[model samples]
Structures are given as structure tokens and as C-alpha cells.
Target: MSEQLIQLRQELAENPYVTFDSDGNGVSRVLDVEWDFHALNQNKKIIFFGRIAEKYRLDIQSYLYALMQWQKKNSSSGSHAPVNSLIGSKSQLNILATRWGKSEFSLLSSEREWKKCTQTLHGVGNKGTCKNLASVINAMLKAGLVSRYVYKRDYIQWAQPDAGNGQAIAFPEAIHVSILKTVVEFVETYHPYRHQISAAMEKLYTYQDEMFNAKLKELGVSALSHMQMNSLRNRMSRITSQWPERKAIPNFSFHRSGVWLGTLLRMCFICVGLFSAARKEELLSMNKESYDDSLAAVPKVSGVSTKGNKGERICMTWNTAPIAKLALELAFDATQAARRYSLKRLANGYQNGLLTKDKYDAKRQDLESAFVSSDIPYDSEALINKTSLKFHIYRADDGFNMKEFNINATTEDVEEFDLLNPERAGSLKVGGGLPKLSPHDLRRSFVVFMVKNRLGNILTVKYQLKHRNINMSNWYANYSELARTSQLLMDTQLMSEFNEAIETSAVDAWDEIYNVSDTLSGAEGERIAQNKAERLAQGEEIVMSRSELLALVRSGDKSIVLLPTGGYCTNRNCERLCSLMDIVEAPCEHKVITDKAGKRLSRERDNLIASFRAINDMGDYANELILDARKKKIVSIEPTLVKHSIPFDSFNDDIKAIWS
Candidate 1:
């Protein structure tokens, strides 16, 4: 071994491959190399070059090919980079043992013997397999028996790890040789490496899983169960579905129109995504100002705008230019409308008002906004202190407000104009506000259009979607394709249902009737007056107005207030309740134990006192009232009685029949 090393060192001194002044060093490469030969000598490093040294008898080309094969088979680093496994000489030697057809490399003899029957033929007993194998191969290679074939693991080729199909057999060299050849060829030719992509995604997912597992374990849980995985499954499903479709570029301008705001917004978002692909925060924070100066110089726009900071080589397809043009126009229109509204307000002098400009109005009034109100041409100088003159008009004319105008429009004038042309607003139904659509829908529609058009590079498409990775971008490509193929739009069934529910739940009418009861002189009114008088005599007051009284009587303030005993309000100190009438206006199931004067139960007694026991059988509305589930006592109560006065017997009886 010493003689071989001496000869090898002498040969290395003049060998062109070993002596070249690589990396701009004046010294020969052999002397300049930072390779850990000394570390190898001290049994601290594995010299991987040793494996194929004497395995084949051939010329340098054959040696190179064989070395490449060996590297391909053994290398774990995905790209052409070596990873430090820190395997010492012993492990390399153990690997060499297996390569040379050794049965096992045992570090612990007693344990090795104990598990001999269970061990496989080529399995190393955790002894110094890695280091020993590397050292042996490297030594032979140094003696000129083999050439080093430097290669990285073709992770794309070996997408899935071979776990050897459970049925054990001797490791086959032929299979590895064939695989190595294919891996090398595949790497040389760029192709869609589905397996490799899947592997990378899996590794990332595994890392995320590990982090979550650590968190769960720290919270005193063992391995996660199916329930926990299921909880996250919905998000995972979305991610999985999204992954394959991210990289498809669609024709963003194909569906350009006056009505598809959702489509337009989607295109703008995608353009923003493309420009600011790497900065998620910046992309999200982008506003009209982002496009000001950089794009304003172009002949298409009138004002300066700025966009998020993007790299210089932000590639845009020809199709993108039109979409960007439209986006800028919309942004300019919004900015202009806002500016007009602000100017009108200033023209009228300061007055308490709530308008669209208020949300982003922070700067000094001197700095006039480039974008002004939509009515800049006709009513630029006019001012209104409320939502808008148009919104008022809509309320008066149509009897309902359009909600979309609230989110996107500057004033009532804008709302009225939009509603007047329902066909222009994508044939949206006229009654409700803005047709239940959102700006995000436009983003989706734009991507779909882009996919339909096939207007950008695959990579460009992915970046345009603002995907964090190529995999995500690829997934978006798939989604774009699906959207184009399907031609679907936003589903609005739920929105319609929601509007219906809001209108039907009209408890406010009861409040109105009670409001006028204060001036009543009829027989029923006299009865109410008498009730108020009796309540006042007992220290209770009928302080609530007629409208308030009716609301309390007919409707349950389900969210804010509760009726404890069928009709009496439980919170006695609640100012909303009229303590004068003891009529409380509202009904509740709770009450305080009172004295002869009908004053509240004492403070000490109050602490001990509680309303009649109530049990909600199911859902939000209380159906059954039980004193105690174990006792099965019949609780009794009157709907209008105070909560505390209701007996458990009556309380249970009234609720039992309804519940059962």
C-alpha cells in the first residue's frame, strides 16, 4: 500500500489531469487540492474513488464509463454536487466489502451474531461500511486501475427509491448498470421529469410534516391520527389540485369586454404576479401608484403609476401588453374618481362625511390626486356629505341599495349608472348590490383566458401566477387549461339565498309599532299606561318608547339579549329594558327574587339567585328547558313571566311538548 501510494504520488506530480493549474491557482492542482487525503489516512473520510479501481480491466474510456456508472449508482446528491455524509473509513471499508461480494460488515460482533439469520447477504452490520468502501475504491483508482467518473445523482431519473419489493434477493449489478445509463442519458437531455418533480414535492411535504409533527409532539401528542390529517386534508386537496395547473399561460385578452370585471381583475392580478413573482408581500400591496412613472411614459396612459419592484428581465408576452393596458386604465379610472370626489368635497368646504376616498385619504389636501371622481366632467364641483347622491336615489327609486357600489364605487351616482345597464354588468340581476361577484373572480377568469389563448412560456406562465416554485406554477398551468376547457363562471346561488334571508328576517317593524305606542290613548293604550303605573309604584319604570316596547315584546334579541322566562328580560340592569313597567319591554326566562315592594332581590341573595334552569336541546334556538337532566323534573313557566319566577315544573312542561 505504501509503495502504491508513493508511485501514485509520483505519477500525480506530472499527470495532466492531476497537475493542471485549475481555479486560477499557480500551484499544480495536485498540491493545491483541498481534498482530505490526510483525513482519509486518519480514518475520518471515505475516499469514494476506490470502488471501481480494480473491478474492470480496460482503457481510460472504459474506466471512465465504469466510474460514471458507479457514481450514478452510489451518488445521493441530486445535482452534480457532493453532500457530506461524514462516513469515516470504516463505513467505506464495509461498503467495499459488499462491493467485493462480502456477506456482511459487522461493527458489533455479539449483536451481529444474534441477528445473523435476520440479516441480508450484502447488508453491513453498521460497522464502517461507508468509509471502507470509499477508501478501497479510491486507493485502487489512484493506482491507475480505474478513472474517476465525476457525476451527481440523477434524482430526476430515480424519482422513486427502490425498496426492493419486500421479497429479498441479492442486489443485482446488471439492474444498477442499466439504470445508471438511463439516468445519465436523461440528465443529458432535458425532459419533463415527472418522477423527479414528484420526489421534490414529496420531500418538501415531508419537511413540512416533520415540522408539524414536532409541534404536535411538543403539545403532548404522539403521532397524528387520521382525524388530524383529515382536518388539513381540505387545504392539501386544494394544493394538490392546484399544483399541476400553475404553469400554463392563457390568452388574457381573449375575453376582454365591458362587463367581465372579474376577468379583467384576474388579468391584472396575473400581470402583477408576473412582475412581482418573487415578492408575495409586494405583489399583494401593489396599488395604482405602482405603475405611475415607469408605465406612464408609454403612449397608452395619461398619468404616472408605479408597480411593485420586479427584476429587469420580467418577460411579458404580447398578449400581456393589452391586459396591462386595460388594468392601468381601470386603476386610473378609480384614482380619477377618487380625486374628483375629494376635489368636490374641498370645493364645498369641510363637513362630516363618509365617502370612498376616506379609506385611502391620508396625505395633505394640497397634493391633488391624478385620478378624480367619475363625474369629473359633469359634476366635478358638486359635493355630497353622505354615501353618494346616486346611492340615495337608488334607495328611493329601487327601495334597496346595491352592495357592490359600497365596495368599489365612489358614490351613489356611480351605483346608479352601473345599475341602469344590467346587461353591461354581465346581465347581473338588478335588485341586489353588485351581483355577488368579487375582484378575485376576475383574476381566475383571466388565468382561464390565458390558458385558452396559450400566450406565454411554461415558465413564464408559472411566474405570472406568482407561484413560489416551478411545481406550483406548473399546477396553475393545469388549472388554466381546465378553466379554459370548462368555461365556468362564479357560482352565485348562495348569494341569492343570503339576500332572501336578510329581507325575510324583518324584526324592525315590531320596533316601529312600539315606538308610536307612547302617544296612544286607546283602551289597549290605557291598559299599557296602567301597567306602567303599577310598575312605577313597584319601583319598575316603563322608560322605553312605544316602538322599543313592541320590539321587546314580539322579537327575541337572539344575539345581544336573552329572554330567560318566556317574555321577561333577564338583565334587569340593562338600560335598554324599561324598569318602570316591570314590563321590561322584552321577555326573558330569568328574574330576581323581589321584596314586597317588587324591588330587585337583595345583592347577597342576587349572588345566590339564578334564572330557571334552561337546556338547549339542539341548535341555536332553545327547544327544551330542563331543571336537571338527571332529575327529569317537569320545569314550568309562562312565556311572559320573569325568568326567576318560572318554576322548573312549568318550564320543562312548556318546552317538553314543543321539543318532543
Candidate 2:
């Protein structure tokens, strides 16, 4: 490790809070250092040996540097690049400076001094500061940048392995199925109507364009193409992919308002997200034109937003509700309406409020693009259905705002709102005072439902969950509580079956009871398992006599009845292996038949006669042989039918008819 990091580690190990938790008897558990765990200084975070630096993919050096910068100047690393994002970059420089005196990322002099200084970063309530301190210092060591190793052994002892799903940070919850259902209901109840731009809005955009064009004409300013507008907007918006370069567009004041459209589209996104499990970024990236409306039963949605393209139709009869599809339809309409509304608003602005004939003729060239024609009037029907409208559920001002919908509230000044629209926010507030649920949680829950509902086989569930490999599918299956419970239940049931077999017949039973004790909440499964084990241990022959077995067979306790002969082969096309009797030939009384056996015997007799008649048509000689064969077949069926008390009058009549 680098010299700086080695010294930093020495400093961290000396901190009082870095010690492990212990009990009077022994070590109880690792105390604190949890991902969410905090310390005393409200502005700084506590770093410990057990912290997993790589969990958040943080660069330790940058984070430590940022923390030092913040401690010294109350400012971040001043990289003004993505590196500034390591930690504490979003906070006020002055506020950070107020918390800790100026500091530098340098080697420490002594253990006592290091420990005293580290107290500032240790056990701090402000996780951001703690993380910054932890990560940056850790990164220096991780990169082998530490030089001085005065306390290397102590440092090694302090850096313990992480305890569990270590650094347990807050992730979005799996939006409960019940809450999701209510949210859907809310959408349906208060969905906004499609946006409709008034005539005055058209005049506003048109006039604004004219005022700009007139000044440009006086100065000979060339007309800007639509593509150029997009380029200018993008260029002026962000010069760098960092906090420092953020700038607002110079020319733009207000584009247009589509608040209703935003609200409606949010519902659409939610519905699609629940069904398809689209991440916020993926859902927003979807184009209105991308929806595939074809295919029977479940219409397919291609590109349903994944790191890879697994977006085939997962709309199985079980996993999805019909409302999600309806929501998609609504989303499409909302998208179209928003576009129509914005374009018209801009066009109207260019034309001004006044509807004059002279303005249309004079500004014919510039108006030709968005307008219907130079001389033609604005057609509301055509305007809405215009082939060129592009509305991409982006943000409230333009498209959909996923950030707003997902967040509980934006700021204090603005009114907090949701479909639930709870007042004074106590309970029943959507995404508020509740576990935060992300799109991935919805996905995990979806897999759980697949196992719980038994909606699909393993392969089918895998396909629906859109897993790339069977290993991942198996991993998810392991995640299912229902699946785990089912395994326990099946094991218990098998033990019951085995115990019964051992009692009625002689066989060694399987033991292995204690192995599954953890899964068996109720002792019944364990008891059953124990019974079999005890019998096996006793070495007692558990077989019953033939009479007992016969009696047991007649007891109607089992599903498939057993007989001395082969099974009641209800298959009419059988080879007659059971007691050497086939359905076409005869019935075997010893057959372990179904209740439908009586009907089979009756069919056997008629089939015999039919064959006899067909052979008789050939000649008398052939008929004689066929008659003999048929007689034996009829005789075999008559005995079984009579034994079972299945009326044989029909068979008796058929025999007479063939002879007569």
C-alpha cells in the first residue's frame, strides 16, 4: 500500500470506535460499523476496519481527499469532475469548514496524535463525511500507496472481514402487492384527460417566432433548423459531465407546461414498471413508437429495458394483471396528447394572439414546417394526430418525471402530492414513512410470486423473470420463501409415505430427521420423520399379511388400488398381460380396476361380436374359426362382468344375435 494509506490505516486503528463489540463472557458481536451505522459528530462519519470499501465502487483516495478538502476548506476535492462525487461534494463548503478545522492528507507523527485527530472522522452521525473519510483513506491503502508501517500489525487486526450483506445500506423495498394494487386503483380513479391546447396557445408561439424572425430579418439572421435547436439546447445545457459545468440554457425561459400530462404519464410508467420491472432510466428511455400492438393473447413489448435485450413478452396469464396493459394504452395516449399540446402551444406563440391574414402570408416560409400550410388553417384533428409529434415521457415541463414520481417529496416549499394524497403525512402516505421500493425489488418479488403461485415450471418462471441463465434462475428460486417451505412439506410427506410402506411391508426406512429440524416449524413433519427413523432403528419387519394387505386395499385410503394380478388396465388397446386378459378379449376379476371397469367389460363384448360379423362376411369356413375365437372372448368377459354384478344381458343378447 502507499505510504499515505499505511499511515491512514495506523491512524484509523488507533481510533476508539474501531474496536469490536464484546460481552462480559465473550465476544458478542461486531459492534456498529454497519453501513447505516453512525457516530457522534453529526457532520462526520465513522470509519472502521470492518467497512467494505468496494461495495459502493468508491475510490478510497478520492473519497479521503474530498473529506480532507472538506475538513480544511469546507469544500470537496475541487476536481470539478466525477471524482468530486466521491463524497461530501453536494454539501456547503462553509458548513463543512465549520465542522472541522483545516486538514491535509499527510502521514501522522505519533499513535496518540493520530487517535486524537481520527476522533473527528470516527463515530460521526453524518454518514457522508464518514464515508468520505473512510473511502479516500482506504483507497490510498488499497492502491498500495502507504509507506510508513509503524502500526502495520495493529492495522491488520483492525481491518476485519465484513460481517454479512455487509454495509447494509438502504435499497428500495419490494412495493407490496397490496400497495401496488391500491396505486393502480388511484391511477384509474384520477387519471388526467388528454392534453388539449386552446387556440390562444397557438397564437402565442406564432407571435414569439414572428418577433424573433422580424429582428433576425432586420439583422439578416439566418433561420435555425429544428436540428440546430436541439444541438444548441444540448450544448448550452451541459459542458461537462460534472457538477461544475451545469448551466441553464441562455435563450429558453419557458418551453410549455404539461403538468396533467406528467401526472398521467407517471401512472403509465408505474403500471409498466410493475408488470415489466423496468428501471427508472429504462422506462424513461422508451419511445411511444416502440410498443408492439400485435400478437394474440399477450401483446409483446420489445426493448422492455434491460442491460441486455431479454424483452420478449413475459405477459403470462399468471404474472401480469390486465390493468398493466390498459395502462400502457393510456401511456401512449398521454404521450401523444402532450406532444400535440406542446407543438400547438409553440406554434400559437409564434403567430401571436391575433388571427390576421397578412401575418400568415408574410411569414409563410418559417411557418411551413410546424404549421399545416402557409394559407391553410390549423386543423385540431390533424394537429393532434400529426405524424411528426415526439413526446418522450422525460420530465414535467416536457415529458414524464420519473424522479418526482419515485421521490416522496421534492422540497418543503412545494406542495407534497401523490395519488394517495395523504394530508399532514402520518400513515397511508405513498413512498413516505415507508420502506423505499425500487424497480429491482419489484423484480425480486415477481420471481417470488412465480414460485408462490406455481404459475410456471422452473423453465417457464426463468423465462418470465427474463433471467439470462439457469444459474441465476436457480439463485432466484432459492430466494423464494414459498419454495423453501414446499421443500420441507414434500420431505415430510415422503416420510409419511415411507412409514406407511414400512408398516404394511418389510423394508428399511430412511432416517435423516434431525437434518431438516430447522425447516420444520411444526413438529408434525419432524414427528413423522422420527417415526420412520425409530422403526428402522428397531429392525422390525413392518410387512402385513396378504389378508391384511387385501383389507387395506379395500379400505379406500390410497389413490391407486393394488390387486394380486396386474393392475386394472383400463386401456382397451392393452396387450392383455393382466391375468392374460385384454379388454377386447375379456376382463380379469383379479384386476385392480377403476370404477370405469364395468363400462370396459360391456365395450369388450360388443367389440368381439363386431369382429365376428366382419369375419363371417368372408366365408363360412373363416366364420366358424372367428366364431370360436369370439366365443372364448365373450366367455372371458361374461365371467368377470357377472362376478362384479355388471349386467351381462347385453353381452348375452349380442352372442345370440351373432349366432342367429
Candidate 3:
């Protein structure tokens, strides 16, 4: 083993969490094999075990490398290392360690072995996993633990793209509208008596323990039997039957009341998630002080984004609609008993000297978290799990009859929903069950709705989604069904935007031909220039407003299609299927070449001339036809370049020497 590898192994033996900084200061991360990423709000841990811990031990080096890289990244920019990335790295490394056995980095040098190992991972079907594994291997290679030649040859040459897992489908428009309407109606119905319902729930919570103890004492037993517990629940329900908020609460057993209230809380969570486009962690980390509507016009929700803030919890604020304010209020009221129970426990723990000051402070911060599990005898520290949250969301969805709300899905809506969900396609009908919902689906649907309606672009939506880059924002908004359907059903505002885009293109073309360029090319360009000259002779300015150009385009007197070759094609009825390669060769009379097109032509001419010279320099007789075709292409671009006063080299004696 190399000296660096021996040192890394020794460090791992001493401390599992050791990481070195620029000043050689050792910083420890997690002290256990099962890392708890509490800041990430994940329910699971990144566990290293079995082969990763025993025979192979590749995880030691890979983990050390990941920590160093994370520290380097954090030092350069204040971006947090995502727990998901670490989990993915651990998973991929475990697979590699299992496949290669004790050979480890020795087997990685062989291209055949690398292919064999990577093929086994193809079934994993995650491009991010492949990237994670590659990052660790590359880091090892840079640290001189693996051969650098293998890094350049084998690792870079392999390609394993994800076939997609189909977890990112956006909710259809009909379902989205129905969910919002259902949540809004439910919140409005119960919001008026929120205080009374909270008080009643608190009363039920307080009486449950007292009644249970009293029943145990009366039965002369320490614990109640199954039948005894059921009888006590009935007695407690009868006792609260006369409460003023009985009508507001759902009709359920007193012990199962948390199920109904939890559903209400999840509905409010959905409302905030949908309107604000916040991630699941950001939404779950919200506290009582998260929402503010003092400005009335622009209400905002505050939370910490742990994704890219360099391991520091940076507070981010999202502007939301007024309905989000109602959702926040409803969520606060729904978790009232749970919050009270948590505070009471914290107070008792601190007073009895059971908890240190730091632990008490940490638990106190959790007390203010807006969402929690609503089980009776509530878990003060446990957040709601995905399964229970989805179950309640589904229950709320199934209970809200779409027909009563007059929500009828159109044929297009059903077709769009099917396109998004191919496996369950044709299962959604006009009045059938709604598709399964997830928090991510709401986020994707939000992006699709905003982009499809032209409310914002991908970059603007990135801020709302809390994405680190525009690429992820693009992925969330990649609803192909919406894009395909939008063309067939363009609304008036969309059509106007389309027309405005065309007018803007035409105005830019005309502006270049009249104001910027001293001369122009093509038949249409010459005619427009002569017309502008005559107008100037008659003491009239040639400037035109976008509205006037839009009128012309709408009236069918003018048309413009911006070409990829940096010019405009004005012949609306022309039948030439021209491409970038053959654009200069096309004999279309309506082509208009402005200064921008002239510059583009000049660059193309230079590139063609360089290719011609390089091929001729090879001194091969077989290149005659290729050289002739490229020479003609270069010749074809010169007229437009010369007409617009763009300078270029003519084929003279100096250039002809290459053809010798």
C-alpha cells in the first residue's frame, strides 16, 4: 500500500469522523457508523456495514475523500454537502466493494473488470449513483491511491445513463385544482371555530390520562386490558359529547380523533407546499414564526434551506398568496396539543435536571416546529412520516367527491394525466379516483403550471423551488404533455405573447437593416433599403413602433421567421426547406441579411477555408471532391458577406499555394 493509503487507514482506525482543514486542524463530523443527518430532515441514516466494514474496507478511504471534498467545497463557497449525496456515495461504494472483493483499487485498473463491475450497477438505474461513484474514484485517483491512467481511460470512457424511475410525474390540472379547492373549503369550514376546536382537543388530551388512571385504580390493576381500554374510550367520548366544538370535529372515536386532525394538518401542508413551491424539508422545518402577512399584499413564509448553504442553516423567505396565511393558521391550530405537550415535557425535564441546558434549548427549538405527528399522547420530537402523511392526504382526496364540487375532468385533462402517468394511464376517468399524490409531484406541478402559464421562466422558479441550479428547475418543469398540448390550445394571452415575440424579431431585423448597417444583402434587403432611402428623402424618419409592426404581421402584409443562420426569412409562401448547411446555397429571393447575418457568414467562410486548407495539406489525391465541395461552400458565402461590408480574404495566390 502507498504511504497516503496507510495514513488514511490509520486515521480511520483512530477516529471515524476525522477531516483535515487547510491549517491541518482536525474537524470531526459524526462519531458513529450510522450517521444521523438531523439537519436534512431525513428519516433514515447513512449506514456502513457488512462488506463495507469488514473484508473490503474501501468505504474508509472513499468516506475520508468525501469529507475532504466536502470541506474543500464548504471553504470555497458556503454550500452545504447534501445528505442525499453522501447516502448515494455510500450505496454505490458498497456495491463496488462487494463486486471487487479484497482487490479493490487493484481491480479498477483493468478496463474489462471496470466494465463488468459497472454493468452490474446498470440495473440500479440511477445516473446520480454512477456520478457519485465516479466522484469518489476520481478523488482517490487524485490522492495517488489509484492509477491516474485508469482515471483518464477507463472511468471517463464508461457511460451508464439512467432509464428513469418515473417518480417525477406532475399532477394533472384537474387533480391540482380539485386538491386546492378541497383544502380551501375544508380550512374555511373549520377556521371559524379553530380556537374552540383546539380547546376541546386539549381538554380531551388532559382528560384521557386522568380517566385512564382513574379506571386503573377502580379496576385495582396497574394497566387496563383491551376491553377496559375500549370502555374507557367510550366513556371519554360521552364526556366530551357536550363540548361546543363537537360539530366542528369529525365524527370519530375520541382516541382516533388525531387521525382526522392530522389529515387537516397535512391538507394545510399541501396548501403551503403547492402555493410556495417549497421543498419537503423546508416545509417541515417551519416554526410558528415562519409565516407573516403584515404587508397583506405579499405574505411570506420563512424556513432554513440546508441544500447548498455550506452546512449552515440559512434562512430563506418565500412570498406566498393570502391563502397560505390561512393554511399556516390552520396548521398551528391543528398541532396545538402536540406543541403544548412538548413544551410541558421540556419544562419538566429542565426543572428535574434531566436535560442539560444545550439539550433543553435544542428541544425548545423543536417545540416551535409547525408540523408534528398527531397521535394521542403525542410524540413531541417525531415529525410526520411520508406513509402517514400520504395516507391522510389520500383519505382527504377520496372523501372530497369531485361531482359535488362540480369538478369534471375534460378529455384533454384525462389524456394529459395519462401521458404523465403511463403505467396508470386510462385509469383516470371523468369522475373516477384521483391519482396518488406526493410532495414532489406538487412541486413539479407547480413548476409546470408557472412555466406553462408564462408566469415565470426556469431561473425565476429556481428561487421558489430552492434549487441549486437551473438544470434541476428544468427537470421539474419538463412536462412534455403540457408542452405538446399548449400549442394546440393557445389562449388569447399566449397568442398575444407569440405575436409580440414575432414583432420583436421583425423590429430587430428592420432596426439593423435601417439604422445599424450602411448596406444590406439579398433581394428583400435591397428593396427595404431603397424604400428607407426614399422615406428619408421625403423628410420622414424610418423608425417604426412594435405595435405598428405587430399590426402589419397580424394583417398578413409582413411575416418573419428568424433562421438559425442569424438571418430572417420573409417569404411566408416560399417552399424551400433550407437548413444551416445549405442556407447560403438556397436561391430564395426573400432572404434578408442584416449585419448580424453578415458577421455569421464571415465566420462560416473562415471556418470553411481553414477546413479546405487542412484537407489539402494532407497531400492526398482522394480529397479532390471533398475539397471542391468545401471550396464552393466558401465561395457561396462571400457575396452576402461582401454586400454587408463584412471583411474577408479572397482566394488569391497566397491561399492557392495550399492547393499545390
Estimate the Cα RMSD of every predicted model relative to the unseen true structure: 33.3, 23.2, 12.3
Residue 641 lDDT in candidate 1: 24
In candidate 1, stretches whose alpha carbon ends up further than 4 angstroms from where it belongs are: 1-319, 322-436, 469-478, 482-660
What order do candidates take by TM-score, descending?
3, 2, 1
Per-residue alpha-carbon lDDT of candidate 3 for residues 1-660, written as tens digits (9 for 90 to 100) = 666667666665655543323344443343444443333333222334433555544455445444555445546563334556555556666666765553356456568876676665544535444555677667556655665343333343343443444555666776677777887887777666566666766777787767877777898987777887888888777877766567656552344447666666777778888888887767776755688888667789988766665445678998777777777777776667766765676677678776545445545555565665566443322322112221123343544233334456677678777776665567568766555556777788888877876878888788888777888888787764466466446567877887677777776665666677767677778888787788778887654555676677668888777776556788887667554345346556787778788888788778878888888787677777677767777777778877877777786412333334
Candidate 2 residue lDDT tens string, 1-660: 345455545554533232122221221112333211111111112233243333321223233433443343432432121212322332322122223342223433345545654544333434434444444445434434432233333333332233221111111223344446655874565334322222222333354445546645765757556675466435533532222211221111222233434445555666666665544544444443335545556654443332332221122222345565556555554344233444454456446643223222222212221111111112334332222232233332422333333444322211221111122123224444332334554455555555655755568756756667877665544435544354456688787886677545311111111221212111233344456467657884442335544454446332232222322322234344543445354344323332244446567677767787676566555256457657666666565455445675643422222333
Q: What is the Å distance of residue 394 in model 2 from its true position?
A: 13
Task: Arrange candidates by lDDT, descending.
Answer: 3, 2, 1
Segments of candidate 3 deviating more than 4 angstroms: 15-85, 94-116, 139-167, 215-244, 248-257, 293-297, 350-359, 376-410, 418-435, 480-570, 573-660
Of 2 and 3, which scores higher on lDDT? 3
Candidate 1 lDDT by residue in tens digits, 267-318: 3443443323322223323344444334433322122111221211132221
Instruction: Output the worst ten-in-a-row residue range by lDDT, candidate 2.
Output: 35-44
| C-alpha lDDT score of every prediction, in listed order | 0.32, 0.39, 0.64
**Which one is best on TM-score?**
3
TM-score of each model, in listed order: 0.19, 0.35, 0.62
